[model samples]
Target: MHQADMKLCLVLLILLFVTLPAQADNAWQAWREGKALLLMRHTLAPGSGDPAGFVLEDCSTQRNLNNEGQQQAKRWGKLLRQQHNGEITVYSSQWCRCLDTARLMDLTTPTPLPVLNSFFAGRGDGDKQTQALMQQFAIAQTAQPTVLVTHQVNFTALTGIFPRSGEAAILALPLTQPATVLARINTP
Candidate 1:
């Protein structure tokens, strides 16, 4: 091969080896540092919040997280424990899926916050509740890392972005303002 071609190939190979591991290490370090607040979409639910005839007050009528989703939630908790010593404050929507996901984590009993539920259910009261929730997160004083298990709509409303099922959007919460998205984790 030409000297120039050999040099270019070496550089490309170096970049491939160096950059990929660096990115992965960064992601791992981000988790270890607990600098990111995880906003997770409830695990493998087949449908959205509920059926048309679903009732907000009753989980039996809603489309909840299934057995596989429950197992996935537990797996996520195990991963967090292994990676970060399992220290996190978990918050969840009152909905069945979100609540179930939070509970399945087996980390802590999550605080049930109605504000984290999706506004897409035509729930008019969610706007005010969402504002209040945002304000609370904005002014939180705790140093422990936080996690929120919620629906896609609520996540989008807060972060202005949509996330898929079982996906986590990491946010950095500063002292006085709303949080900012740091990165996203889509765990298989």
Candidate 2:
């Protein structure tokens, strides 16, 4: 074969043999294998903070998700179910936006977790809350992928990563050890 033709064939072989395998071995695979925690910030709420008289039980009083945010949440749910074959566990903060996002998902109903609640806007104890979440993550079984729908502050406090609205951070569990970020699933 000609030298140029041989080089072209070699390049194709490298792409198929080396690059393909690396692409196939993504962080999603680790999440699918139950080795990571999917930490998701709630979708766009259309405001910086809640209103003056915000109430946890009443969504209208809080900075709720706008139409676009609702659609974003649904799309994420669809993508997650499609990718994981409908195997997922969703835990969410009690905040209206977080709960709405979780409920819109196709996964299991989100159990209200105070630990997952946002500390932003002076809502609660940031340090204690983050520690509580870490403790649960450290001991909980990881046989099935777990999704935590929370806020930016909670995520930052736990993983020191500030995810964008509707974004997700894949964190390796066992809080006693140094945290490892496996992936960052951006908005769809």
Candidate 3:
């Protein structure tokens, strides 16, 4: 990344942390009512992007989650279990880090959704992926709580919020154009 762009990203991260949401109740309430869609970035994987010769089919070729990330994911799962009772459909990106994060949560066998896949290495069209994600539940998967475990780029494309790893944005229903921002969560 360019120095200037890197600095800008750092600034944004600082701002997001500084403005972390205080109304945890409201965010939980939306979840309890099954009126929100959670879009979360996968937990920490040490570095920024995948290494050279990054292969999608091989976990060793990707950035997998670290021990700290594993702990964070487990904590989130326990917390979610405490907060929302009933089934939670977890949709994960095809990336190893994302899949592992979702699996560690144990929130259900996370269904791999292509649209939730990271568009970071020019792998997919961000705009198109965002649209597909929004339309994914237009007819079904609306009655239950759904969580999309994905990458920072997917969340940014959908909500214009550059979410930190392990951060989440709870979007209001009908996740189409101009989706509502219900809450922002920095999960453990």
Assess every candidate by TM-score. Answer: 0.78, 0.83, 0.83
Q: What is the C-alpha RMSD of each candidate to the true structure, in Å?
A: 3.8, 4.9, 8.4
Of the pair 1 and 3, which is ahead by TM-score? 3
lDDT of the candidates, in the order given: 0.74, 0.82, 0.84
Minimal lDDT window, size 10, model 3? 135-144
Clashes of 2: 0
34 Cα displacement, candidate 3 (Å): 2.2
Best by the lDDT measure: 3
**Mind giving the per-residue lDDT tens digits that candidate 3 earns over 1-188?**
99999999999998877665545567677766767787889988899878998998999999899999999899878878887779998999999999999999988999999999889878889888888888775642367788889998888877888888888878877786656677878867
lDDT of 2 by residue, 117-187 (tens): 87887789988887788888885349787899999888778777777899987777665333577666788
Instruction: Compose the digit string of candidate 1's lDDT tens values, residues 1-188.
Output: 99999999999999999987676556556545655567788887887557877777898888887788888898888866775674778999888888899888888899988778777767546567657767776643346667889888777777777777778866665312234666667754
